[model samples]
Target: MTMDGKVALVTGGSRGLGMRMVTAFAALGADVIIASRKLENCEKLAQFVGEEYGRKALPVACNVSDWEQCDALVAAAYAEFGRVDVLVNNAGLSPLYPSLDQVGEGLWDKVIGINLKGPFRLSSLIGTRMAAGDGGSIINISSMAAIRPAPEHLPYAAAKAGLNALTEGLAQAFGPTVRVNGIQCGAFLTDISEAWTPEVVEVLTRDVALGRCGEPDEVVGAAVYFATEASSFATGATLRLDGGVR
Candidate 1:
């Protein structure tokens, strides 16, 4: 799991699980590129990483949902660190809707663009460079809703299902040099969880074998595993980090 002398680029790295991953990689001796829509947040985290871990952190403002911004992000990372040894596609969103029929096209496109399209573009660009170079790892952060779709998150679920497929397909496309994998997360008490209704939270907590939602830091182990040689034998696999959701 040692990342000394490596560079990691993480989307949504300003906070939540992404933030934890950025800091973890830094602690392991990897310089980081933190990309998010909020430049201020990214800058703050970057400063913290430099002071706390003595690792270089580059703050880039990017909305992964846009293809142009994704392109710029890749370019910026490479320009800063020369190469990205690890890429974590952790940016995603699932907006609440009152009814299925009320789910408009804008919402659908936004969900798909962020959860599926963004990862695809980033993986294709970065994975190609990684393959051409010394090799790298790409980790897509998916959701349990991908397999167990509900009325509340149908669009989001569909997007994540596509992300799962993307992970497998990309692993094959960039294999032998670059590896791609996914983490199908269950309910986690991140900023997003604050939006979950009480009933929704209760049901998810009851369903999980652990009888509770996961903390943001709990994702560090899986994130580290996929990012380093710890998961060298794993690729095209989606590890369930749902606390044994049944």
Candidate 2:
């Protein structure tokens, strides 16, 4: 799918699935803006993308959870590329893990703020710009945990589930303009896996029909599909890329 004149903004694009999505977008001929909380990491990825693919890759520091930063990110993308044709809400956090009785307020808020509120805020900021332009596509990176809880990751699942609802709501609210959809990813190899042990990985993979964990590039396929004209007829839909785990 060619995105010749498209401009894509991928949050958390410093590494992992986010970075892979950025690469996919760039390969498809979209000028990409990679944003994350770390400026150095963003710059590194942007430089690599430019050198390897000959695509225009701009790096900007942004914490998606912050409203001002989200606005600044969209503004920077507009300034660099003249318009944003695709927005990938890929930044998220899953730090809070506790039983209902043991969950703390701080943990709850942090999880909700990053995983749910961040996408909402970013979509709001970018959706407005897309409306003013000729409209664009919004792809939210959700998790299979949103549909099936992992017990320990209660807060994360809840936030992601709520994010799915928000995606549908926004799709309807901005229909015939900005198309909104979510990708429910399964186990993927990323820095997040650093927290899991070999044993945990085995257990997780056993449940998947593929009997293996996925690579970040696998998720990129979905992002590319959702962002391009291929999915022009799709909206308010959650595409699952979980290797048959769900």
**Against the true structure, whose TM-score is highest?**
1
lDDT of every predicted structure (CA atoms): 0.95, 0.88
* lDDT per residue (tens digit) for residues 1-246 in model 1: 699999999999999999999999999999999999999999999999999999999999999999999999999999888999999999999998999999999999999999999999999999999999999999999999999999989999999999999999999999998989999999889987787899989999887888999999999999999999989999999999999998
* Deviation from native of the Cα of residue 218 in model 1, angstroms: 0.7
Alpha-carbon shift of residue 78 in model 1 (angstroms): 0.7
Q: What's the lDDT for candidate 2?
A: 0.88
TM-score of 2: 0.95
Off by over 4 Å in 1: 195-197
lDDT of 2 by residue, 192-213 (tens): 8889899999988888999888
